[model samples]
Target: MEHEATRITGTDLDPEAAFQRRLGAVVQAVEERIAALLDDAPRRGEIARPARLVAAMRHAMLGGGKRLRPFLVIETAALFGVPFAHALNGACALELVHGYSLVHDDLPAMDDDDLRRGRPTVHKAFDEATAILAGDALLTLAFDVAADESSHTDPAVRAAFVQGLARAAGLGGMVGGQMIDLAAEGRYGDVLLDEARVRRLQAMKTGALIAFAVDAGALLGRAPLGDRQALGAYGRAVGAAFQIADDILDRESSAAAMGKRTDKDAGKGKATLVGVLGLERARRERDTLVEAAIAALASFGAKADILRSAARFTASRQS
Candidate 1:
């Protein structure tokens, strides 16, 4: 007899399997390009002092991630008719910044997660000091990669792109989100977090990088202001929906299903949509946000199919 399905047992139809079948090609192409860029990243020279730090940096950066941010960059660029090669460095840079955040977020002082992407956390696999340095290195190197003029034919446009990325990855965006997350833990104990406040947190934390991804792609493709605005709206909606879905999965999904620890949010007293809204309401909100995300892509016509699929996947993903 065939082995019973593990995580997905009830239904004969597998949504994730179908999604992977449709998205696997795009994901593979994006992964290969990202891997090449990562492999080419310089870790260290013959210099002795920083060699260990370089090695740590390489280890953390090379370790696994979904590369979702980079994929967003590539997909958005494709929607606008930009060549994937032209946006590869920007996409890679986004992934580097994202990886850096994960490394730092996994530290004992932060989320204190021992596992990530089904592997030992950076701080666990490597030492704590090494993980810290690795995160810093990736964060700094992301800007360096983005600023490389050789990647783009137009130096002026490349400079603008670099500036945009810096702003997004720095205090105004991802870093700011992290700061808020750190501050909010256990502050308002047992009080129901209002929807607006949760949305604010989600926008800064999760939505910022996503918005950056779309904006960077639009810039690379020389898209008009209208197109950029539309894409930005799409990113924000889907990004928030993604986080909400994550909240749902954290409560309902098993550890094996998530490939990481579950219920950590509730354990930490963190504010989430599920924490604020009831579970049923949270699921409804996610669906609503997903619909809004898809609607935002309506201006793109058929070219936005990949983005539409991504939005649906974001709301429906078990992982």
Candidate 2:
């Protein structure tokens, strides 16, 4: 045990397996917490709404997925010795935002998909209006969850969490990237959306929330400003790699595996690194970004191996 604590090494079989198992547990824990919160929240006015709206929101929120964003929030907090229960309380907010985004994204006005997490999309399961309302409700609930005082001991910490969530899920982040994505359609052959633009769009669309997830942990734990900043940078890098992996999967994987439509980006003629650069080049870029993400954790020494494993997993994941 002493040797284990003092050992210094990169990600190996044991750590990788441990990381996967931990991620699985964190995903389950976050899902359970979010469900319970949704169930009990209306009594507290945390999120009160019609039963139909609540059901739609529940449909969109609780389903099968990686829950990677929540994983980041909890594990990063653990790096600073924050208890999993405390970190989980705040991390659920990010997952709500993510679920909201997915629900709306699959609407006829957006990505227009009919499946999510291997089930009928909210819009398809109910109606378009219900799906829209569910997304709006979830987004509102996310801020409420972030600001809840019970999640943290300090008011300032709760404020930071709320503010961070706003920025990451706001116009400058996910929403803005989505606008770029919708606008970039069919501009594949044009210079309107170059590589840089696409990457920025990717950063905003996917990376911002991820960076916020990792940063949320540090904020709740009151980690040093310097370490928090480093983790933010790490999150951005890992987020990029994660998107690139998605691009790869879209090109190669089946819709059954992803539980949603595949090749949609290419079909839309959207700008992607895989479409801009070739597959090999995108793979190289993803690898490079993963290394950068890992490098950003150097400040944490051997203790950061879990994060390193996460970055590698982002680049290598099949779905």
Candidate 3:
């Protein structure tokens, strides 16, 4: 069935409102997809789904957040006229991986946060062991969703998604970035992280999956090489801006406003562009990235206006 975003009117009349409507529709779609994916029934070749594990996964994955990554997947795919159903599958898969990351990130071994999205984190709501297993299950399920026939009719597209998602979530991508972040926090040793290294770390930890959101859309649409490269550049810039904006929020926004603990990055001495360049400079850098991101979409003209708005929103978000 067609999602609500495609049926919206008056893009020329009120672009911002139109964008918000589209984003809301995609968020709702993602929420519904996650619930179905986390159902108690076991799929083919799988053993029984443990009650507690599935509950923990559902608790972490559902009922919160903007679902920005999924929005990117669906919106970018729409650029090439891929149907909402095909793109929504990829969106849900990406969100599953993102949800798993947050579960792991909030563990005692990592950020150790008690709250997430204004509620108790998975580890706090459930036991640490259950949280770990839930995260593992979510990550494994992501590949299953990506490879499922619903994600794409072409086996080649499915294979590309599987390979791309693995690399993005694997040792060289988000996971590797987390390790570098830990090392910077004196987990392994007191290795001082410079600005360049911090940028690289954030790119992997936060940016890889985001970039993959856009790239997945391109792959689903079978975009030309030049268009794919352009989207990649736009994705990278937007990802960087997003992390910077997040760091700025950590410094300036309150826990109540952010729906989680604030000022923790400074307390932990975590390296961030905001810390390295200061708030004003970080804001400037973020704005610059947003501008670059918008510029990268010049070839697509008004067709990418919503994407341009997305880049701007990344830099300007309060949380």
Error of 1 at 141 (Å): 1.3
Report the Cα lDDT for candidate 2: 0.86
Per-residue alpha-carbon lDDT of model 3 for 76-174, expressed as tens digits?
Answer: 998899988879998899999999999999999999999999999999999999999999989998988999999999999999989998998889999
Off by over 4 Å in 3: 9-12
Judging by lDDT, tell me the better candidate of 1 and 2.
Answer: 2
TM-score of each: 0.86, 0.92, 0.98
* Model 1: colliding residue pairs: none
Model 2: CA > 4 A from native: 1-13, 46-48, 186-191
Candidate 1 Cα lDDT to native: 0.75
**Which model, 2 or 3, shows the larger lDDT?**
3
lDDT of each: 0.75, 0.86, 0.91
Error of 3 at 143 (Å): 0.3
- Sort the candidates on TM-score, descending order: 3, 2, 1
Cα RMSD (Å) per model?
A: 6.7, 4.1, 1.1
Q: Return the top candidate by TM-score.
A: 3
